[model samples]
Target: MTLLALELLIMAAPDCKGNSVRGACGYGEFGRDINDGEVSGVSSRLWKNGAGCGACYQVRCKIPPHCNEEGVYVVATDYGEGDGTDFIFSPKAYGRMARPGPEFQLYSFGVVDVEYQRVPCRYGGYNLVYKIHEKSYNPHYLAVLILYVGGVNDILAVEFWQEDCKGVETHEKSVWSGS
Candidate 1:
């Protein structure tokens, strides 16, 4: 069996425009801010569908209501396909779909839009899909740490940290997976 795990971190300033209280931390080019209601609804649906193995596995975390601090929200999705399963993690939709096996499993990160789509970001020859406005340095980033799984007895682990460099803050990670 093959399992694919993905972890993503989305950061935003508390003072950022839009509805920060509800997880919408910044504004977009169209003058639209992150819509907390929309993100939560979509995330809930994704988790609901992800919990069942007959289809796919999915999970999401949104900004907490009591969190008044400006920072990043980390969202992680762990997808596993049995020996013949096929799973598709659509970065654009911030969701995943799969057949009844463990052959095709993928993980990704990004800021989701009101429509639950990923905004494009450039990385190592591929586009990092996100759901937030691409223009502003909202610091919303999606990183694919580990994409491999050994056998059925394997476990995946992921961790993150923030670093200050040249007046800029960026996230770092230490990921490990084994059977």
Candidate 2:
């Protein structure tokens, strides 16, 4: 389902143009080139406490003549609270949503009215990847970030289980807490 059906003002972050600088999602350098640098930072409502990290969305500006109908398909690689905005797209993603000759015009507007919807991510034949956080030091602690999660489902929580002398009982704990 579309997270926000109503049109809202969204802008492109000047600093987020190149090398997907780390954001709240902690994807680090790897997020830089994801989807060919066509990525976006979503608001808290859509961020869903990191569950929206790898979610994909189809976003298009509503500006006539300056906007293209196809819109850009972007992955939520980061999170940030915008000023009355739902997304802050990278330069590439923002320009991709504009018509051929009016890209500069669209950029001049800075903030444009937009509508976005949650969509399935496409990564060809690649499966979901789990990247162990660099800070993890094995038995001491483990932190994993899921990448390329293709579906629209939210990863509300992650659980780790172990088989012990407790007669195959399950031990459950939340790896990351939303609260």
Candidate 3:
């Protein structure tokens, strides 16, 4: 099986402002509601000074909730505190939240989820290694390589690295697309 690929979604409350205690500036989620079939989970976190709460939550997408196929959701409540603002999700998280299913895997590292958007590419300009996708934040890229290991969930790997071409910074982005 490939390492989990996840997209991150963020939401913030309106009252917070100017970066919260987490030293990050973004939206805040005073309240959250997740509906899965007939089951639901609700939680609340605090945001102060337009700062981020630094809280992360996981939401399962699989019908039975697979251990590997899940997404991480984050909310920065203090983003637009002093200024007029509301909740916002990181580009990486937003992309993941948009799709809820076991069709793909998602993994998160630090504040960024590199596996959010994946595009395919060729290896050594000849062999087909995997797909490549652009990072939501910067012009960089990510790559998702496929492994033929015999299993219900075919093995796949996601890798992130920086690439420089003609003075332009480009990276390879990849994610597992359960095919």
How well does each candidate superpose onto the true structure, as a TM-score? Answer: 0.16, 0.80, 0.21
Compose the digit string of candidate 1's lDDT tens values, residues 32-69. Answer: 12222112112333323332111112233232321112
lDDT of 2 by residue, 44-161 (tens): 8887766778788998888878999879998877776666678877888888989998888887877778888888788886656676656566664556666676566666656544
TM-score for model 3? 0.21
lDDT of 3 by residue, 1-179 (tens): 23333322233324212223232321112122111111111112223221112222344333234223444343322222221222234334333433455223422321223232111221224333232322233444323322111211212233343442222221111123221
What's the lDDT for residue 150 in model 1?
Answer: 20
Best lDDT among the predictions, by candidate number: 2
RMSD after CA superposition, every candidate: 18.0, 5.1, 16.6
> Candidate 2 — what's its lDDT?
0.68
Q: What lDDT would each prediction earn against the true structure?
A: 0.24, 0.68, 0.27
User: In model 2, which residue pairs have backbone atoms overlapping below 3 Å?
Assistant: none
C-alpha RMSD in Å of predicted model 3 compared with the true structure: 16.6
lDDT score for candidate 3 against the true structure: 0.27
Model 1 TM-score? Answer: 0.16
